[model samples]
Target: MDTRERYAAYAERIAGVSPSYAAWARSLDDGVVSVLDEVPESKRQPELLFAVARRLGADPADPGALRALVQEARPALLGALTSATVQANDPRRLAPVVPLFAALAARVGRPLGLVDAGAAAGLCSIPDRVTLDYVVGARSEVVRMHTASVEPGLHLVAEASGAVPTPAAEPIEVRARVALDPNPIDLAGPGAFDRLVEAVPPEATDRTALMREAARATLAAPPVRIRGTLPGDLDRALEALPDDVVPVVLTTGTLVYVPGADRQRFVDRVRERGVHWIALERTGILSGVAATLPDDVDPADPDAFATASLDGVALAVSDPFGVCVRWLADPNL
Candidate 1:
């Protein structure tokens, strides 16, 4: 099968494995069917398309009807295709978009400090200066790297491995810098190994799980405490910051996990601060939030994160495998 066909098959298999994913696949398939009627006959391929459509309750066996439906729903299908591409290439899942925030900070003459709201193991927290090199086949390439620095007084506390004893309170007034010397370790073996494992056809050994454990071992190490900010209660912790300090709220893979209302509230709070909010979150969550924005509101504005203010905020979407990066900055700011 060709690349697109393989991807379609992978999507189908993934849908079968997870119910949540099945729902997403069904939604997309339904959309595809609804717009299929407008699609040209040359583009119609009921067998391949129906395999995908069936996941969303379409009759895959009815090739004739499916083709007719596809043609009738071409416009919506086209839109769905665009959305899928965007969703597939979301920057929140990747690390390349992290540096754009630093560049923006330099442009705005503001101090660059990152707060990863849903920082899972803080793997993407590495400074922009450190290049994450990955080997694909014979070529060694730099996937993405940034030279940006974490803000002063930034503390990251996660569940420790051994019995180090959790602290009573978060650490305060500490200067934490990204370590580049150790080099970004992959321990997961090959480049794109995680993605490969994830895209593997059915019956593939639980390689993804194994890779996760290995990544956890290599990536999740000692938690750092700086400036008294703990992982939990980010908003409350940030509010206590000294008046002089300007904060940039950032997160990736954490926003989608949060409820829609809660995410909006968090964004609103970030805007209230009148500082930069760099969010590297899943495209799905971003799209959902963007849909709710007022028609007059321009998401590209620096104050877009806030409900009623000019506070600067920027969003960068990352891909699911954490590879590609797409940035959305406030043009007005």
Candidate 2:
């Protein structure tokens, strides 16, 4: 699709997920899209557009307000586009998958030492602090729903059809949490914090609230954030962990930014270390994992937001932002 078509489709998507943001997106004239040309290759990403909009103080409910900002603040928009990297990572997404991580830790029967790859602020590293309400069979002849509260004030509710393996809800013992990033966000820095918040759509109030709470929780006792890129620095980061702790590597929506070759090499490096691995990335982004999936799964389907993989096997398909989740009937559990 061309840039116009891509943004149009993104507008349609936002209409479904967030009507307020959709108004702002649809109001973007072709001239506005053209202004995005100031940046080399970011006009196609919804995240960048929304982040720029938020930074401009565009209220999601008011499209005319955003349009006015675009017309008046061209320099500011262009500057943000040129200077800001796409650090649109959210910890709320990890809330739905917390059980999956706990399940993996239980299977290993060891204390976890988390190593979050592409962890911008290390928010995704602390899944142990969020509560999840999972419904395996929703509105079926036999529906099963269970709520597990691990931490205060953070909850993710999800549902799936058919029979599924019950994920263990017991909190995984995490002794150390390490975050790896090319440039780690300093929680104390207002600029860095604002960038993180602006990356998410303003219409997602639930997400925004959860983010602030999670950010505070993470900052209370910050994780060890290593300043380095992935694959190249994976070994060094892993080696930095205490010898007694069992390393569990996590990558969520991070591998999409990595080259396919490097993604595979990163996976290999994790396995070579004999550590438990959990990854949540867009479908078909990782060739090895995509090839492992059944032929029935189609990346072209808009509903197929991402595939959750355990050690390289595709287990469940989930919404990109973790609003919903559906586990495979037989995930090789």
Candidate 3:
């Protein structure tokens, strides 16, 4: 009936479906729990919450039950909240979601050039070169933004199996005049730092460990060149692009934070530029049953009553967690 009761029911139902998820639920720290607790009841849509919870290993069969459990556990969960902040405040959380964008980019046969609106610490500024190996079957040139002595520019190259060839011999190109931002964000609080640490998957290897470490160091000692700019200011950045360029705009879990007017203006700016693609992931509130339930509830004639829109369009609509894969192709070219 109440919010706390609803969350408790949700958790219980999830534990019932997949016992493994119970372990993950228990493993979540107070900081993480705090995030779940603060989700406003008005914005809390059962289906999206269920889908995300399921993806986090909650039972899929009875998502409503999980919703009830979480609702009931609200106070205890709130007590666990170390800080009142969104999880995206930490950049490492965005790592897992990057591949979805990359795969989508590759699917449409377009090379991606990312524009991070918040661009905090540039965590998502440059695509992690390692992800390309698994999805795109290649490596990207790592843009060195930390050092002023080293030329700042984009490198375009392919790596052989488990080997890093000399930059001179490879297809690497250096632009001496390109601007570089060395300063990122100063995330000194324990809550933010711990989240970054916990986000690293257990399967991470020596290279991933090194990369994460480097990212941490960069955050600690950001380059003086680093600067913060609003999403609307990107119009100049877009206009400066060369005539031959086809840019793909991407923001992961960042768009929703922007005010509606800014978001609309940013979209219009991109559209006016005739940009090739715009990819983003945003959260939307919706009811769990209404969003996921089958169109035809009639058990007697299942096939005849089945939904038509599911297959017609790649309508992978989940209520709370909106995983969007859309692109606006340049109509003129």
Candidate 4:
């Protein structure tokens, strides 16, 4: 597609996911998006546009404010766009995957060494620190776990289809926490912190608050996050885990940036080590995992969201950012 067409499509996607950003992107003339054509495709996300606008003190909800920035703050916008890679990192997405993590941990029946692959800022590495409230099953036979506690201080809610997977009788013990990122954000650094704030859509206050709370909990005693590229650095990161701990490699929406061959390679390598793999990635991105999905799944739709798998077994289908979850029947977990 041409630059104009590409941006138009992006606008439609942002509209479905983030209406505020959709308005700002649509307000920009084709020439402006074309000017950013030189930017790598991976960096040309709707959040990038709003991140720059937020940094320039423009209110994305106010068209006039955003338009003014587009017209007058061209240099600043361009600089922010070019300076850093987009780190679509948010703890909100981890909410839907928490139950699956718990279920997988129970299946293994042991304390897990949690390792987050492509862990930006490593906020997701601390899923056990947040409390979860789950409501599952259909309306007539609904099941509610009002305070399905993980840790404390933060509570998140999620809706699930079918029966809820029972969390392990004993909370999954996270003996060690390790994160791998090409350039992990330093929660202590002001600039890195601001960039993380800007990464989410400007209108998502709930998500913003969640990030702040997660960051506070994580920084209280931050886990060791290795800064290095994937595939190439996968071995070294795995080696850093404690020998006695049962390694559980977790990757959520991280494989999309990797080449197909490398994704399979990474999976094979993890399996070779006899560790369990928990993948919450875009639908159809990985081969065997997609084949295990139910036939009715539509992998093409952007809103089709993701398929969550544990050790190549499909368990749940969730909204892309994990706002909702529909647990599968007897996932063999």
What CA RMSD would candidate 3 show? Answer: 12.7
Instruction: Give the clash total for candidate 4.
Output: 0
Q: What is the alpha-carbon lDDT for the whole of candidate 4?
A: 0.72
Question: What's the CA RMSD for each of the models?
Answer: 15.7, 3.3, 12.7, 3.2
- lDDT of every model, 2 decimals: 0.36, 0.72, 0.35, 0.72
How does each model score on TM-score? 0.40, 0.84, 0.37, 0.85
Cα lDDT of model 2 by residue, 1-333, tens digit:
666676677777767768776676677676677767666653346677677777777776677865677688878887776766667668756744575677776777877888888898877877776665665543533232223344443555666543355655466677788889887887878676776777677667777777787777678657887988778999878877798888888889888667667878898888788887888888988877888777777876655678877778777777667656666643325
The full ranking of all candidates by lDDT, starting with the best, is 2, 4, 1, 3
Better of 2 and 3 by TM-score: 2
Off by over 4 Å in 1: 1-94, 108-111, 132-232, 239-245, 287-318, 326-333
By lDDT, the better pick of 1 and 3 is: 1
Give me the displacement of residue 75 in model 1, in angstroms.
47
- Candidate 3 has a TM-score of 0.37
lDDT agreement of model 2 with the native: 0.72
